[model samples]
Target chain A: MSTDRLRDVLRNSTEHVDMVELTDAALKQSRQITVRRATVGATLAVVLLAGGVFGAANFWPKTPGDGVNVADSGSPSASAPVEPGPSTAEGGGEVTVPPRIDGAFLYVTENNGLISWKPGSSPKTLIADHKGGEDMIFETANVSPDGRSVAYNTTSGKLRLRDLATGKARDLMDVYEGNFCGTPAWTPDGRILITPNTEGKSGLFNPVTNKYTELSFTVNGCQPRVVKQGGVLMVYFIDGSVSHLRGIELESGKVVVDVPNTAGSRRATDMSAAMVTADGKVRFTMRTTTLNGTLGDGLRGFGGDSLFELRDGKLVDLDFDDRTMGAAYQGGDGLMVLRQKIDGKYEVSIWDMHQGGGFDTEDEPASLKDALPLGYTY
Target chain B: MPDIAAEFTEFARTHTPSLLRAAFLITGDQHLAEDLVQTALARTHRAWRRIEEGNAPAYTRKIMYHQQISWWRRRKVNEQLSETIADTPSRGDSAEDVALQLTVRKALLQLSKTQRAVVILRFFEDRDVAETAEILGCAQGTVKTHTFRALGHLRKALPELADAMKGNV
Candidate 1:
């Protein structure tokens, strides 16, 4: 049977959810007004910080009395220029993006402990304490592709980069880690760390040179969907309508292809985009849109976003309730989820792609162990 | 307060079905699913301060997962298991219930709780190992093991699924 047949069987099962009932439940607990208030409030707070708190938020000492000496470090920038990674990371000196994501997932204990899920049948092992203080309000945490490195920030702004491979750590100060970030991505070259800001900017921090460089802004207010395209760090954006894709150069702020916006919802064709990895040829794009919020923007309330992927010239389109945030695809390899269906009233649901576009099964396993040897134990 | 009430009410409305489904999977009782939803909400309400805006879905899901696990553990020690599904259609008689769904659910129950959790997290939730690991509170390896074992159990229970899962795997 064709692959579509199996997917159909999965989606068409009689025991599926009742969509109406689900929507009823979601709307029951949700409020349109309060969410707007909170959102507006938060945005206002950000605005305040950007204006008056700038000197304090961006370039000030932690304590009120302790003055910041911009030149105390006596360096052009707090971070030095990270020499371009060797030709390649493994041996060539430059860091190479891994074709696939492989690593163990570690969890911090409820209070202050760190637990690791290693390979094999063994239970989780406690790795360390938060050293920061139990007041550790669950800051951001990230793991490297090989699972040998993990970095996180504490309730305090102190940044901690742990070498899982060596059990050592290098601390970076004044990080201001927010809830969104875990750690910087380790490029294939492994020499520089890459981070994208919601405001359409990318940051490269070179630990070796202690220098930091900000890449030209590409996409903002959304996760700059990252994928390894053509051995280069590529991020793609599918416009609001899923039409028009542009590849933006992070370093030089170049738009490779200038894709125009889709004709709007009135048009039958919706534009979406995503990344595919079979061979090494993909482009990093920073897409732009042209539509404005007229009345539909404020009155219709929250906007929506489609999580799409472009693979083999195919656009896998998915939808999200939160239009501001982008979908995250890990490891730049193997079976990137193209689109997910959202029931009315907003529930995140990724359909069974193999089963002809339906929700994922409740009984299916969580890992890809059936296909590849896995590194995570949980 | 009105907005909070509205938001809470909305959140309860939309996610209640899935939450009920999840609660039902763990509790094996409809009454308990209702109670589980209520219990989870009380905690969710308390967490509203921290979850006011950002990633509310993720925050709520984490709460639901923890609440289910807690509900499972805190209940009275000795529990009774129901052998038959309360509502099931006869096999040859396809009019009443979905034979496939019932069969899958039955087979799913055969595995241990964690295995079921892994299966649901991996497939149903469509989360990567890191995300799944976060939800299950286990290592990525455990997620993999549970997944493989769950699949193996499913196949042994229903070899017919092999045809459907073939290319996708």
Candidate 2:
């Protein structure tokens, strides 16, 4: 038939399809997929770091006063490690990290609950009832420095912690009245949880006494991570448009490091920012608009922002390979997770700054095999 | 930033019917057509911020086309063919019109996935050969070849429409 006739036929054929119902279902699916992607991003970061230090002796040097002890060089005995079986929960499975990676436990938040897995042990669900929904808070939950407790907020705005040893969950406090609380950051001492409220304010909740302390500072967008040097680095929209990274001292509530004030750029986008603190340093990704009042071509499309590190009080370009997409998160003991987009697939790797190493710099690329092919569990 | 949910709701309300039509032509099943539109819209929702405002419908269309091909490729073996056409008569459509529509859909099921996609994008969607090639991530020549082959198959399957096909070709 004529093309117009065919178009008319096709268009009229869908008269019975309910657009409203389809859109509603699509919206729910979209939100779930976004959450799943965020969880996958965090899980991949941890797995990349775990794979990086797996098995070689003297890979990580323990530093004094560092809170998160990811590895003790002499801890894993000379005995052969046990191989863990498959995961028992639905949509959960065991990912085999290389046998050489000793004492590395990867904690992933899947649809069923928070799961913890070692190199060879079967994946075990730490909390069984953790159902992910629209109200589920936290992009990436914090595993305490001692690795004893996992802290996250539920969809109902209640901050809860699950004891890894007992699989028992304890309600810490009601964080807010809604579903979208930003991820909480744990202090170096693991004594307090810094939770971000949807409305520009942050609260420090002491799990010991179940008390909440409100911070005087306000963040316009995105959550903040606590730096090792007793400062909180947050990305906030200054004047509602320009994104700025300001470091505030936890005790005095004073802005210690305002990169935008020193660097002289006011074009950052609020939502297009991510920050990670490792080795007493901060690395962040920010999207900036050009002088022509349009987003730069580099930051216009998907995954198109460059990572910058605050070094010597200046924002220095990490200058990773053009293929490197962005930085994800910083692991304990100076490991930074970076994602490299090669041929449209994201490959996660760990960058070590303490080894005089930087992305696409003097550091050798970590050799990691593709593990955890569970494929977007949520 | 605009409220993403509200913006998406408005966009979907305006475009969902058209998208469902395109998806119906692609999938050749009513239930599967609704699913295809929902999946495409869901993907578009995730990238709504990155996609320019006027490009939402085009973005969703692209996702629908790619997702249909991917699904066909993954489940080609298990796809059950409907032996009979299940056509719901539209208002003002006579028995002959409904029969012709069912015939066209049946002929569509006979074409290869790529050939069917090229036909839908080029003819029904009115995308030029270059635009079809760009959407399908193929060379313009490939789109031309697919369109030619697909039309030839349609003409043979529905001889009654051969005159119209000849006029369009």
Candidate 3:
């Protein structure tokens, strides 16, 4: 596909597929066991059996290195299938880049407490730990979009809004098993936090009055991803360089964005961020050898691929360099540019938006504001 | 065992899509798909303990698939246009892609329920044979057979998509 063509397709490929009727039916199917005093014990016993699985794995579908097997149900790749390989479950990701280096990475605690690394000149000081051993991580701990105010999940599994200001915490919902790690999200209003599985169906829990308003839908869950465009909660996963963008509104739990990979007849769902031009061209950030060396080694053959379906009658490939892109999110504004070192010093360059996007030797950001070349931070 | 409302809310927030995806794939109609996903999710919510204990996506998918297959048992399931994506106009590099997707979807609807399940799981979910088998609770060879036949049926249904397979990544 041509570059312009890919951008056009990505820009316009929108189809809303609502499955709410299924929600109603699914809700009817669930037999809600009321958690009263006598049954709470039995309920806990049940939760211990189920919820305990969550504790067993903090992040499933993490990555190759993150050393933890939340579940072994994942079938080995036919490309390479093994029931269980060595537990190469290291931290599991190439997130060793910047933004992360300076930021106090947000992680969920077992009992829902947000830990922050307040900036200090000394060796990374742990300035703020909510000291929340009382609640489960799923309920209490939530990080803000701007990365402030850590909400508290309780031991009994309730979501509490904790004000970073005066150190006061209040119960947002007493009836919820709301947990942050469980992908709890705050609505755009922040007045109500959205959760699923209430009213014998999926519903929203109000923080102010501690009540849950039953939504007509009866399903639970979304991956809890956010889009910069509409501060609403949604899900977007990239496959190779092309991204499969799906936006969901937490309000009615509707999927607003469902752009099928119409660019050619391809769908490589192995998505990662490379540099993208503001125009919506997605590129690759890392350079990796194929599992079978399909593309061979080091530059050449039939490599670069960027597929996009335009609204017009044509599908095109966006132009890009593949020498620099491999498989990691470089950096970007509209174009995902990255800072790579040249001759012992770092320089900012345009990253390839191809399937295995590469780095562009040309195109320098105007110097004065572009000290980024010297490695300000990735 | 947690507060019913709270447990329900949390559950709803996360698992709804899995249900819908399974349903939509099974019954080509978006409305019916929504019903299937909702019905399966609600039932799962009822037995939250068992649902929670067992694998979630699989449990929900099983419920949804079975519900959809037995649609004749009760026609309470609505088959109509839904309000969710009503305004979403299709914009692809080519109108052909949208046409292709719709065509593929229609073709999928023509297959047997299990055959449809095999295709959706294998290609859409990108699962290998064993995982698709596990999700379907069938023997690995059954999954392979289903997938092979499903592909053949798809190729027969949409020769254009069949021709494009060589370019698939």
Q: Which numbered prediction scores highest in TM-score against the true structure?
A: 2
Residues A1-378, candidate 3, lDDT per residue (tens digit)? Answer: 332332232222223455343343445334321212123333333444443343322121233432211111111123211111112212323211112222222323332333332122221211233454555433324443223334444555555565543455665554344333333444322333444442324455544335566554433322222222222333233222223333344444575544433344333232223233345543222223323333211111111233232234332233221122212221232223343322222223333332222222221222212121101111
* Whole-model lDDT values for every prediction: 0.40, 0.52, 0.39
**Docking category for candidate 1?**
incorrect
Backbone clash count for every predicted candidate, in the order shown = 70, 7, 112
Per-residue accuracy of model 1 over A1-378 as CA lDDT, tens digit each: 443433343333423333233333333333322343344334433443443322212211132322222121112232221111112223322223221211133344434445443222232433455455612323334443334445455555445566553566665444543424323444332334555433325565544444556665634312233445554455444333334454565445656544433333211122212343455434221122335422111101011243333445543332221122111223443222211111111122222122222211111112211211111210
User: Going through the candidates in order, what fraction of the true interface contacts does each contain?
Assistant: 0.07, 0.40, 0.25
Q: Order of candidates by TM-score, top first?
A: 2, 1, 3
> Model 2, range A281-365, lDDT digits (tens) per residue?
6554444443344432211111223445678876654433122232222222333333442212334333444443322111112
Q: Considering only chain B, report the TM-score of each candidate against the true chain B.
A: 0.74, 0.88, 0.78
Q: Please state what fraction of the native interface contacts candidate 3 reproduces.
A: 0.25
User: Which ranking of candidates, highest lDDT first?
Assistant: 2, 1, 3
Candidate numbers sorted by DockQ from highest down: 2, 3, 1
Instruction: Encode model 3's per-residue lDDT on B71-108: one tens digit a residue.
Output: 23122222232332233345433668765555666576
Q: Please identify model 3 stretches exceeding 4 Å from their true place.
A: A1-14, A19-378, B52-54, B71-93, B163-169
**After best superposition, candidate 2 residue A254: deviation in angstroms?**
74
